[model samples]
Target: MTRAFLGLGSNLGDRMGYLKDAVAAMDDCVAVSGIYETDPVGGPDQGRYLNVVAELDTSRSARDLLELCQMLEAAAERVRDVRWGPRTLDVDVLWVDGETVDEPDLVVPHPRMFERAFVMVPLGELAPDLAEGWSDPANGDCRRLGDWDELVPPASEGIS
Candidate 1:
């Protein structure tokens, strides 16, 4: 099984519920990072987002994972009406077992990971090994919410 990292965020209604539901739908291949509430990053005026990073052990290819993430977003009623607009859910593939994939539709290790604290903080919690060499010299605002175990449900909870 390849290790994959996913970035999830929600700013619309029932943000935490959307996250819980998405994880529940992923079966047993996923483990989530601590959830952090963050300020809006860009695009437009919007609500703060509850963000988390997830680690997955799966046989799915990078492209397939991207598709699956989109499906999860759709299940949460995510819409693309405006760039960086509010959404029920947003899932992004952050890394895939040290593989670097560059394609028209997907990029591994996510092109913007280092620049976003919301992504880095939770990611650092779930897989610090993967985040070892990555750093943002200017990062000063990101704070750890808590331990990953304290943030996500226990593995025995089985997603829901």
Candidate 2:
């Protein structure tokens, strides 16, 4: 199985539920990190986001995982009318093991993953070894939410 990283966020509606349900829907392939509440980084005015990073153990190829991410987003009623707009849920493929894929529809390593605090914090918690190379001057702004430990689910509840 290939280990892949996914970033998830929801700023609209019951954010926690949107996140939990999205993970629950992908029963076989995904495991969530501790959730964090983060300030908005870009785009127009919007609410703060509840974010999490997930590690997926799957035999699915990169393209297949991309499709699954999109399906989960759509299932949560995400719309593309606005870029960086608020949504029910946002699922991004952050990394795919050692592979690097750059395409019009998707970019593995998530193009901007290194720069986003929301993506980095929970990711760091789940994979400290992988997080090592990622922590640099460029990622200085990333901050850990104080209640992070409290939000992490028990290991028996999900893979982490």
Candidate 1 local lDDT, 33-118, one digit each (tens): 77788877777999988888878888888898898899999899888999988999999989888588999889887998888888
Candidate 1 overall lDDT versus native: 0.82
Top-lDDT structure, candidate number: 1
| Top TM-score model | 1
lDDT of 2 by residue, 6-25 (tens): 88999999887788777877
Which pairs, if any, clash in model 1? Answer: none
